[model samples]
Target: MRVGSRRAPSAPFPGLLSSAQFAALAAEYRRACGFEICACDSDGKLRRGGAERPSEGRSVSDLRKHAVSEALRWGEPSVLSDGIEGVLWAIPVCQNQKLLGGLVVTVTRLRRPSKAGALDQRVVSACRVLLELGTRYNLVNAPLLSERRETARREQEKAEALHLMKEGTFDTIRSIYLREEPALIAAIRRGERSAARHAINRVLTAIYMLGQSRIELLKSLALELVVTMTRTAVQAGGNPENILGLNYQSLSRLADISDQEDLAGWLCRMLESLIDAIESNSRLPGSSQLARAVKYVEEHLAEALPREEVARAAGLSPSHFSHLMKARMGCTFTQLLTRMRLERARSLLVHTDAELAHVAAACGFTDQSYFTRVFRKTHRLTPSEFRRAKRPIRNASAPKSQTSARLYKPGAAVRC
Candidate 1:
């Protein structure tokens, strides 16, 4: 994932519902029980909204409010709301005196009273299976959540430690590169090799702190990074890569990778694949204005926004803006804007059948032909071909001949 997802705000859906997991099981329970429809919710509000019995108009007064309302009565568990012809099962899912949600089943409706009574027994039996959802969703989740929390906490700590070690590695390399060791290092900065070394250090740091016990986390991958770094370094006339490669080799035992040059050559795809897999998911512990500005640019790349405008928004003079952006994102600001625009353009080509010209204009291109050339250069596909090839079936409409040409209104260029 390019972006990390935040931890869930609260214990997610109640265990019983979450735990009633398998599709086949839920299907079988309903199919065998002859359920025509069902619904579920929690906190009386039915928050976040949930499954309702197959499409139908249900007035608030007409539906099974009695059973759902029972959260105030039995404080949750299975409940049967009896009506003239059938019964609705309302099972409330709660935790810590909080009603998370529930399962409502209109599983069976029989014409005969005796049959209805018998099916009620069947519903009770299904509840036995479903009651597990509450338990599975609730009880089991606690330990798993704790385990995950601890694991993430440990992983984050390991990441931080590796980050510090990489800082040390860079400090050493940077000191050698600059050949000017400054005392009490305030900031460890290197210009070009930042990304590669960061990648190696990220894994190395992860491995150093995390892989101590296994000694084989990212085992094959580590060797590949070092070797790739070595070859790329050699090709670059032994500048950063060679110096960094030697520094890296001393960091760990790439035991299985030695004497495997042919295997290494077969790994061109793997080398690219590995880099693709490692996204720039670094952390920000402190506040940053330039970071904020870059973030704004990334979020809104569709408009033909200017660098001066963005720099102005960041409250930095254009002279100093690029340096600040490089410090944070490790890339020049223009490169960032181009990347963001290209990404958005790619998304449009792949996801929407918006006219090629319009897509071009939306991505802030000056003209359609220029967009096509740049698109081909970046993605190796012409605009129309990319649209036809990448678009989904429903969205595969014919291309629009008109370019959007939607110019910005006066003074609506930048947002602070």
Candidate 2:
């Protein structure tokens, strides 16, 4: 198939994908996957490739609009459902951190293939291929897609960091990062990519929160992270020559970035590349699976986590995961989980003035009584007693009684 022209009249920017090329790609997807694909411009206008195929109880236009909106907002491939029985996938086409257009794939319930898992994988693969093709065809610089995706990821993380900032003071956030940095480097050396990614979020959020949104400061801190990660990667058996070359290039790029969000994105991407280096040197079998399981536990510590749920997250059967956990960590899954939750509860007790009940709930304990019993068993002090012993002195002008009220729980006596 041949593209007629580089730009479309209705496109918001130059180098818009031509209608013939768009339709050709859509037609290819339809032929292979039995789904209809359409291209929509930045303004949510259906420039080319969309067919007027209606579903039961929903119009095609409504589904297309939802796909377009979701793609633009998230800048990702999102799978959504029409209220009826159809599935819609929105794959955003971006160039240099700009959302130029997107591809929408629609498949009705009745038309879905019997092998649903295979179908889903094919859909994801097709979205990736289409995105690469579309971006490469339109962009003069193919590497800009990474920047575009990073920009979107940075926006998401920025929103999350802002939300977290509202809940903690600058010191609280700064301390969290200080504690997490060692764990981040440790995870990298162990080639636990998933855990490193989780730690990266905590570290990145703290940087964004404490940097006060200063671009130059953010760049400097980002460079510092690069140095730390590169050093850790070398310790993990990554080639020093190759790693340092990448490090120098990252520093050059960091020097050029003027936007805080872009810097955040670049740091994340660079860290992941360092992680890739570390992972390449990993010697353990199923290390990725173990890393995933550890990451899943870390993320769901506040929830009612089960062995089966965690195993599924790690893509292993429960029995296999249990055996793996025992072989690798020298402990049962439940034992590890209990230790992690208790550790988190201990940190919360020292860092924040959250009540015992609130802390218990946040750490996934059944109740304050159970939490206190476990706390006393582990540390020989009740939760309130531990807090009073370990909590730092407050400098606020509020009266002691008023400050104490925040930790007061009605109907509960403080037991030492």
Best by TM-score: 2
Cα RMSD (angstroms) for every candidate in the order listed: 21.9, 20.6
lDDT against true structure, model 1: 0.48
Tens digits of lDDT, candidate 1, 84-144: 4445555554455554445556534534445443444445545545545445545223343
Clashing pairs in 2: none
TM-score against native, each model: 0.26, 0.41
Poorest stretch of ten by lDDT in candidate 2:
407-416
Off by over 4 Å in 2: 1-24, 39-58, 91-102, 110-122, 136-145, 161-175, 178-183, 190-201, 207-416
Q: What is the lDDT of residue 351 in candidate 2?
A: 66
Weakest 10 consecutive residues, lDDT, candidate 1?
A: 182-191
In model 1, which runs have C-alpha deviations exceeding 4 angstroms?
1-287, 298-300, 392-416
What are the per-residue Cα lDDT tens digits for candidate 2 across 92-189? 66665666656777554633565754454455555565555555566323455455566777677667656666767445434555566776766666
Clashes of 2: 0
